[model samples]
Target chain A: MAGSDGSNGSKEKSNDFANELPSYNAENMQSNMKVIYYSRTFMSIIGGVIAGILGFTGLMGFVFYFLVMAITSAGIAAKAGFSVHLYFDSWNLIILDGFLGGLMSFVLFWTFAYDIVHIF
Target chain B: MAEDLVLDTAIRDWVLIPLSVVMVLIGVLRHFVSKLMRTSSQLPDPKIVKEGQVIIRARNLRAAANFIPLKSFRARKVYYSNEENGLLFVPKGQAQNAQAQMFSDPNMAMDMMKKNLSMIIPQTLTFAWVNFFFSGFVAAKIPFPLTQRFRSMLQNGIDLSTVDVSYVSSRSWYFLNLFGLRGLFSLILGEENATDDTQRMMQMGGFGFDPSKSLSAEKDGLDILQHEWALPKFEQRAETVLRKLVS
Candidate 1:
């Protein structure tokens, strides 16, 4: 029992989860996530509108949507002053987090604008 | 690609724009209405707070034990885990059952009912309204091509299988906007807006938060923590730095 207990404590010590900082404030991380979420959503809506107005169809429309998303990711990094370690857990977090989640809004608005300007 | 069908532009003014506009307006209205209905979070019982604090105190002691003298560390550890008066001894069968606690608190159940009413009432009303008025006709065309599999989903309420799968019926468009407008709500009402159905669904699926479970987990963590002073290594490094500076 004592040996098992010792091993449990050792396992916790070996789990290198701190990532450069000794501790991360939970409140700050949540607030950062909210900020990124808002910006990403807003940008995707704009992207969809642009794609629709430009009369992009099929796979090309989807590609343009991602292109807009990529720009938004870069904008976030720039907004953070590029010392992303201080604000975010990792680069992938700011880049890829919620990237696909915004697709629903993108498609909804894209189709709306497409039908409005191009079709009718 | 040249075989494009002409749609009446009047439908855009009447059906499409009005549907989108009404949905957004209803969303904004729902957000404020629910905000008005929300009860302020009541404070947890003092006894629970103190018990939780005891666990935190033990954890802090464990983390900083090496900084204190060995005698002091031993004294604190004994005070926490001693066989007689130890704070960590949750007596056998005395462990808290979270479900029972939830039932015992009448206010929790009331709050949950109020939340459900706020979500369900508006949702049902809006869905009924959309279904009544916007059941027939194609609302808009999808900007991308879809397989035949998407026909049932995208072309709901319309029976014309000969029409392309890219065409969305009015009712299907309403469904699409219902889920898709989540981002728009966040943009409009800020984070944790009350109109989010997905957030409510997630809340229902996750188990209730139990304070006692966290308290016991913290106690176990504190119990297993081992202390080894690193001040001696810091002292060695300081000496080496001083020697280098002098040379």
Candidate 2:
């Protein structure tokens, strides 16, 4: 209902502000989670390739490094939105992905070593 | 003694062949397992802006300058490297503002710096990757035996004057070409260039946009010369235009 006194401008401004809030927040949250997810996945593959090249030495050093980087990157991504839940979720995903990546590398390297030693 | 040596060689070959097969099998199996279990997700939109948004507004600046819109405007800042005498573009926005103010507050500044740095990391990495790959290709094309020995000797310890210029010439051309581009960027952003490469680039861009002086906000009304043409049969035409721009 239009006010007779023409207070409509202020009311419209307030309503516009209210409407803008949710979308902006939503967009930021979505983008942050998206980046965190992608970073974890990409970093995992890079970690795998590195692990393959360097073997046990990579396992001891670089694997842990990848984990740390993934986790930190995830945190940075999550903080971009100021969303607590998104931040927590991103952190969880990063840490889990990192551990899995490390485990995978460990198994791969071990199997490779075994195969090489036994094949001869 | 000959018979003993033959037997030793036979044993080594037998062992190595089987080992190589087993290693391949193990590697493939591990790859499958990792593929099955690994969880990956898409990266969030870099809260930072993308490079396409940067205002690299010079026609034929790289190649096919005509295709690039003259009216097209994008916001960017040019970062000049004193040591390399190079320029890199940064997107314009609140991000650049935050970066310019980094030293005032260490904690806040560092956080902002990290985000801005991350955005450009991909570009620099791509550049490095291409440079190294190109260098490797050039290195591999040298004729073998004599050339290989020559290369190795040069690598081990050779004076710059003693090395073949052909090996260095092509790459240096590439360097100068890109340097001209950086110079164009400096001109566009109205930054003064204290580097020789930027000066040469400015001379080539037809702007005579002196890096020594403050770049004017008004368009210099000159064409740019791209050193390489991605399109077919256009190289000569492009070179002609480039020559005119520099001349």
**lDDT (tens digit, per residue) of candidate 1 on B28-80:** 88888777766475876887777768877887787667667767778888788
What tens digits encode model 1's per-residue C-alpha lDDT throughout A69-107?
898888877776686766677899889999998999999
lDDT, model 1: 0.76
Pick the TM-score winner: 1
Model 2, range B1-247, lDDT digits (tens) per residue?
1221112333224332333343333333433433333223234224212221221332223223333343321211112211222132222341233234345446544533443444345336534643453332222111111344444432322235444422222233233223323322222222332223234444633322122111222123221222321234356767987999999
Docking class of 1: medium
TM-score of chain A of 1: 0.81
Candidate of highest DockQ: 1
TM-score of chain A of 2: 0.40
TM-score of model 2 (CA atoms):
0.20
Q: Weakest 10 consecutive residues, lDDT, candidate 1 chain B? A: B203-212
**Model 2 lDDT per residue over A1-120, tens place:** 001121111111223233332212333444444444344434443443454344433235444455546555555444434333323333454445344433333333332332233322
lDDT of 1 at B175: 85
**What is every candidate's C-alpha DockQ against the true complex, given to 2 decimals?**
0.54, 0.01
**Least lDDT summed over 10 consecutive residues: which range in candidate 1 chain A?**
A1-10
